[model samples]
Target: MTTSAPEPVAHGVGRVRVPMPPGTGLPFSNAYLIDDGDGRVHVVDPGSPTAEARAVLEAAIGDTEVGSIVITHLHADHAGGAAALRARTGAPVLLHERERDALGRIAIGVVPPDLEAWGVPEDRRPELLAAAVVPTAPAATLADQVVEGALGDAQLLDIPGRRVRVIGTPGHTDGHLCLHDEEADLLFTGDHILPTVNSGLGLGGPTDTNPIADYLASLDRAAELDTGTLRALPGHEDPFTGVRERCAALAAHHLRRTEEVAASSGATVWEVASTLTWTGGWDALAGFTLLSALRQTAQHRELVSRRRGL
Candidate 1:
């Protein structure tokens, strides 16, 4: 009873959205095809490889060469098809150095025990411990340093005639990045500032140094950008404007959720998430949503502790 994949819709400047198959747990992660006006096409976040998505990619590019594949982060849904796409198109895959390490952890199913070891409280240890056992790994390794090193703030990525500035937006994932086209004022927000829902701030492993704080700061950084005619193409949902508003809404949502968690003196992460009022259904989306809630709680606790000098 597999659902069909959504059709790819062509956008201006040779960009197209190849939607992944539905009911795959991941709701529509888009594979963007950015034509460089030359014969080369730059694909961002090929998403999980599926027969349908591959077909869409082939159709979009046609005879145009796939210059390179750039990954937003190492999340499986985003980077799963990197290896396959590269192999298919003979295109070199690029990623942040930190993301390469994160990809390695995903490959081995090693969830870093840092969250529990560092800031997670003793009473909440049981639930955190259970979550730590869950494994989410990448399918393959991205061999080369696509963008050299960490793209701090912004770095120009020149592909044929198209130039995209790589902006480091690290709240969703430690090494998460977004592609900004200064000429077009378009930002390829890889799960950073989404249109529908805010990106999740996942556990960065057991050794993460205040990830929630880092994420909040990252959001602020994104909000500070002087964007004009701002159009953001997110990993999920349609492209839209108001990037700053979306980031602020996400921050506020987490802040309120954190306050709620704090108000419940004895509430565990699971309890808090279960009791929380969310927009989407709680069945198939539970794993991702719950992880987001837990990460939010973790960030909230850390912020409170810092304020109190705990």
Candidate 2:
């Protein structure tokens, strides 16, 4: 039996959302193929489902060889197919060095347990934790330093006829990176800014610092870019216009969530999560909802600490 291929949306230099069936109850996460119309193709964030995603990717490439695979972060929905795609295409997988160790921890099954302490009911924790484990390996690492094989803040990649700039927009994940094509006025945003929903920014640890602060800074940075007729090819949504507006909306939404958590007065992350009305049903979105609450709590704490100089 032959399955139909995932539909591809043509953007400036390539296509996005090479499909695999939607799983984990979320809408389809996008997989982007960036080619200069040459035989060389760079696939970004090849989304989940090892076998089916690979088949769709192979179909997308047709006879063209995959030049490289660049991961925006270590999230399962984004990087789950890296190893499989690497083996199939004989292509090196690239990830930011800061995230390399985290990916290793994920591969070795060392990620911290879900924040059950915050009040997620016992019955729901297992599935959410299981889903988080799938993506965490790097075949190759993008170096740390800006010079000497490292990606600079807005450095243009040396791809012939393709002007892709690497923009370091950390926060959703510490090592998250977005690609901006100045010539195309397009941004391949991986979970930094989505069209419909605010991306979750979980707290890694106490000393790990406030991700919301970083996320806000990243939003500010994104706003400063030349966004004329901007089209954002996000990790989960269709390529849409109004990149800055969406970023502002997400920032405002998170700020409001943080305020609400703060006003709740000593409420735990799970308590805040349970109180709020999320878009999707709890059973379907329990995983993300709980994480979002944790993130909001962390942001609230950060705001309080700043007020007292603690």
* Whole-model lDDT per candidate: 0.65, 0.65
List, residue by residue over 50-79, the lDDT tens digit for candidate 1: 676666656656666788788888766677
Cα error, candidate 1, residue 27 (Å): 4.2
lDDT of 2 by residue, 246-280 (tens): 77888888777766656665465667655554566
Q: Which portions of model 1 show Cα errors greater than 4 Å?
A: 1-12, 24-27, 104-109, 112-135, 143-153, 203-207, 226-228, 271-275, 280-285
How many residue pairs clash in each candidate at the backbone level?
7, 0
The TM-score between candidate 2 and the true structure equals 0.80
Kindly report which residue stretches of model 2 are placed more than 4 angstroms away from their true locations once superposed. 1-12, 20-22, 104-152, 203-207, 281-285
